[model samples]
Target: MNLHGWIIYNGNLPGNKFLDFAQWIQAAATRKNSTTTIYKNNELLSYLGIGQLEVLRQDKNKLPDYVVFADKDIYLAKQLEYLGVPVFNSAEAIDISDDKIATYQRLAVKNLPIPRTIIAPKIFVSGQLDKTTVQLAMESLGFPMIIKESFGSFGEQVYLIYTEEELYKMVESLQGKAFMFQEFISSSYGNDLRLQVVGDEVVAAMKRSASDDFRANVTAGGTMTAYKPTQQEEKLAIAATQAIGADFAGIDLLFGPNNSPIVCEINSNAHIRNMFDCTNINVADYIIGYILNRLN
Candidate 1:
């Protein structure tokens, strides 16, 4: 039971899946005489059998030297922190970065330029809905604004409201969840930069083209092409990662009306698979190595 490293990857393994990553790490550690353990939530439950209280009673305190939580389960990472397990990016960082509003707030406080934004109440369901409120928000923030759910990913819960009617409809539709409305930054190039940063280093970068549709996420049918960040843009990305204490992040920057760079969002568990072929850097390996070195 001498485990070398532990991987907290999501999904089941060894059943239409593989432990090759853990195996590779184990091999890396074997030179120092150790093995690796792959801990998926499914596999953990299967091995532990019944309940959490029962499992906790067993006192399996001999955890691996380093544990990398690959998934975006913020709560699980925080729980591991209580167990003194070194986690990548820290649970708090993940929690903060998960919220678009909170992440933007943190960046703004750090003097980072973000799109002029404001959060709007999601409730306007009844009679005499506050038209004045919506009107003021649009006027103060300006029109052609973008509304977003505080915790959505991949352009899923984001919308653009160019008119008061669209804004009202969006507010009525998302009546229970918190939303943010931000001034739309017009990048004449019709693209935004997705900068992948690790430990103050801008490792991989890409240019995402929004098909006249406006949402810059690929899920919204936006195209992603290889991009190289200018030194200033790289500085902005690094500063943003540091602002949120994120060990790994995807800092989304868009060009404003004068080519001014404005941060639109930050993703904690940024998917690197899309950027792999475009950059010379192996982001996954770099992330794995960075976490192992820092947390170990």
Candidate 2:
């Protein structure tokens, strides 16, 4: 029997990147002799009324065997899963990966080597941060630390603080937002590794570097190159993915003082275009193949 799949992406998001990801997966599925349909998260409405839980689209009766969730719409993803549809990188994994603090907590519990991190206190009202909490964070992480919002992508909400003043200003600007303070990994200031892990294997890897910025995010002006990660790096990347219960993930690794691998972050729906451009490897192929094997 031929498998049928649904690739869901966020329609509200600007730009074609999200749609592009869905297309890639659809193409891969087609190559594997499976049929796939692409849908926007908004296109599928989740209705919750009393004892009814229904996800409705144009054809409510036409449900796929599995879903390739390429968006961070946790509710929609969860709804599909509740309907007995297998969602790649399950809703639970997407939830953990979507929140930086939650991801860190999960990794920490698993004893993964993540950078030293301290969750910012939740502030009900917006204003200056508590002096005592600020002092404690500074004392623990020191200057030139990293401040990153809990829910962000493309490295847009990440800030590098060089002094107390900078930290205070950044925190003030981010008041009423969930974020964390992390120790700066000087050894990997402008460079990091992106290892694409699918099912227990590292499918593609790349090194991203930015000379003028502390962030190595390719979307933040960083350049990418094909890379060969060490066994330790590969193992850590895979472990980090599994820590969040992700079937596949793009795991970013920072270099420690002694060149050891440190988990920076994991992207459950990591964009594969950059990796393809760098390594000429289509991660979609691996993703589709993994899903096929699991289903079979």
Candidate 3:
């Protein structure tokens, strides 16, 4: 059957990165004898009326057979699903993957290996944290730990706190934000693995490192090298993807004391351009092929 798809991405985000991803998917789908149109999340409006739910696009009213959701706009993704259009990675997967606290909770329930983490209590108004609570969290995770906001990307919202003053200051600055405290993986400092998994297979893998920064995100000035994942590494990456119910994902694995794999983070809408550059593999081909097969 000839397939049609929509590659949806965030339009408001600066730079061409998001649109670039959509175009890549569109090109891949076309190569596979399928047709796809790129749409920005803002271009499609979701409406609610008495006993009706609808999404209307300014240029087109036709919905595709499937949607390659490359945005973190969970509500729009869910709206598409509610309209009975199949969405890759699913809305729930994106929601869970977008929130670190939720992602870790799901992984922990599945017995996946992750860094020791403590979710900060939610505060509506910006304010200071309780001294006793901060003290207990510090005692449990120790100094020189990691502080990560729940909703972040490109390693932008992650921090390393050394002294109590630094920790408190960082926490205070993040007042009213959903964040977490984590045990820093000293063994994997400035290094981690990015394994792209599609349909239970590791299509491509790369090791990311940074000399000047602790975060291994390439967008954060890190470097990437093609990697051959170990059996355990591959297994864990795939398992972590499944744990979040994602059809595909980029799973970041940290090195444990003995080089054991520990999931650092999972990206449901992970960018594949870097993987292609490092591994010379177009993961888009694997992703398009997987979607076609599933639809067939």
Q: TM-scores of all models?
A: 0.82, 0.98, 0.98
Per-residue error for 164 in candidate 2, Å, reads: 1.1
- By TM-score rank, best first, the candidates go 3, 2, 1
**Which wins on lDDT, candidate 1 or candidate 3?**
3
Each candidate's lDDT (Cα)? 0.72, 0.93, 0.94
Who wins the TM-score comparison? Answer: 3
lDDT of 1 by residue, 1-296 (tens): 34346666566433322344344434445544445566664443312234431213133646656665555666667666666667776888888888888898899899999988887654545443367777888888777788888988777887877888888888777776777878877563357889999887888999888767777777577888888788988999999999988888889998877777788888876766667655655576667667656643
Arranged by lDDT with the best first, the candidates are 3, 2, 1
Q: Indicate which candidate wins on lDDT.
A: 3
**Candidate 3 lDDT tens digits, 1-296:** 89899999998999999998888899999999999989999998888899999998877658899999999999999999999999997999999999999999999999999999999999898767888879988999997899999999999899999999999889899999999999999999999999999989999999999998889999999999999999999999999999999999999999999999999999998999999999999989999999999999
Which stretches in model 1 have alpha-carbon errors above 4 Å?
A: 1-3, 10-36, 42-61, 122-129, 188-190
Question: How well does candidate 2 match the true structure in TM-score terms?
Answer: 0.98
